[model samples]
Target: MNRTEAHFIAQDHLAREGLLLDRLDWDAWLDLYREDAVYWVPGWIDEDTLTTDVRRQVSLVWHTRRDELLDRVVRIRSRKSVTAMPLPRTTHSTSNVLVESAEPGRIVAAASFIVHEHHPRLRRNDVLFGRYEFEIVQEAGDAWRYARKKTILQNDLIPTLVDFYNI
Candidate 1:
């Protein structure tokens, strides 16, 4: 495929992923990734740099594999988890998406995202706005997976209380 075609396909995949997240279909959203996927929410913009040591730096969220993500899902579903109790409904809005790079089976994309959470008990809305940088890979038979996802929060260093399952 030509460059334009490749870019379009990559963009479409990104859009679909965004829509799936917005719907909060956890299983369906997880199915979009490979078993070895990585989800990262870096604390800083330069965190993605090749030379940066992520362990030494602060990060918002980072999961190395699908099992880790599944574990998180399980915890969120568990009634014993106090932080996760009374889960807040959330909507993820993604826009200003740009395909930074694209090959036959790989795509690098960046977009701005806003996660709005509404909790009836709190009687207030929690908004988390950030930028998402993704490394997407196409697996066997037209399946797209998230090789890496880095979410850079606009308020990464701020001191604020957050619910356990808010993200």
Candidate 2:
């Protein structure tokens, strides 16, 4: 497919992920991850160098494989994960979706995302703004799956505890 088409497909996948999460479709959402996918949210670093070393620096959440992702999904769905309870009303807003690189069977995509979370008991809504960097692989029938996803949260002082539960 053309790069433009690939870009839209990837964008659609991102949108689908949001909808799945909002609807609490854990199984279908888990399908978005590839067998060897890496899902990472890095920890804070110095302002001068906007990058943090994934190897040495601590990350908020890092799942090395799909199995790990499955475990997370199971916990969140089972009402065992502390961060998962109450199911905050969330809306994922994504923009500036750019296809950075498109190879034969893969696409490198980037986008800015804003997740608005509202808890029934909370006084105000919590917003998480970040950039999503993804490596999406083309699968059978030219379908797309997430090979890796790196989220960079802009807020150094996050409003609340950060976790992958919303994802």
Candidate 3:
């Protein structure tokens, strides 16, 4: 694919991902990831720094394997998670999308996202904004899937509790 086509494909993947999450289509969403994918949201290392070493410092959320991601979805879908059951509605807006690099079968992409969560029973509405850095690899037939996803939330403290899927 040409550079422009690569950009469009990468952006399209991101847009479809957000739509799947918003609709709570867990299985479809999970299919977007590779078996060894690592989804992480690291905590800030210091008061003044946005930098964090996820390996050395604590992380807000971390899922090391695609299995873990599926497990999380199973829990919520089966209503086993008290807080996550009856999933709240969400609208995820992704922008500033860039396909930073595209090789024969690998891509590095970045985007900014604002996710709004609303719950009718709890009377809650909250917004989370962050940057997403992704390492995506091509699967069979030139399809791309996430190998690693890092979410850097702007807030030092999360306004509300969150999980990988919600964030």
C-alpha lDDT of all candidate models, in order:
0.68, 0.82, 0.84
Candidate 2 least-lDDT 10 residues:
44-53
On residues 69-107, what C-alpha lDDT tens digit does candidate 1 reach at each position? 777767666766565456667676777777888878888
Q: Which stretches of candidate 1 lie over 4 Å from their true place?
A: 1-15, 44-51, 156-167
Q: Using TM-score as the measure, which candidate wins? A: 3
lDDT over C-alpha atoms for residue 105 of model 1? 87
Clashing pairs in 1: none
Question: Which whole-number lDDT from 0 to 100 does residue 155 have in model 1?
Answer: 57
Better of 2 and 3 by TM-score: 3
Candidate 1 residue-wise lDDT at 74: 71
What overall lDDT, based on C-alpha atoms, would model 1 receive against the true structure?
0.68
Query: Which parts of model 3 have CA positions greater than 4 angstroms off?
Result: 48-51
* lDDT value, residue 5 of candidate 2: 82
**Model 2 backbone overlap count:** 0
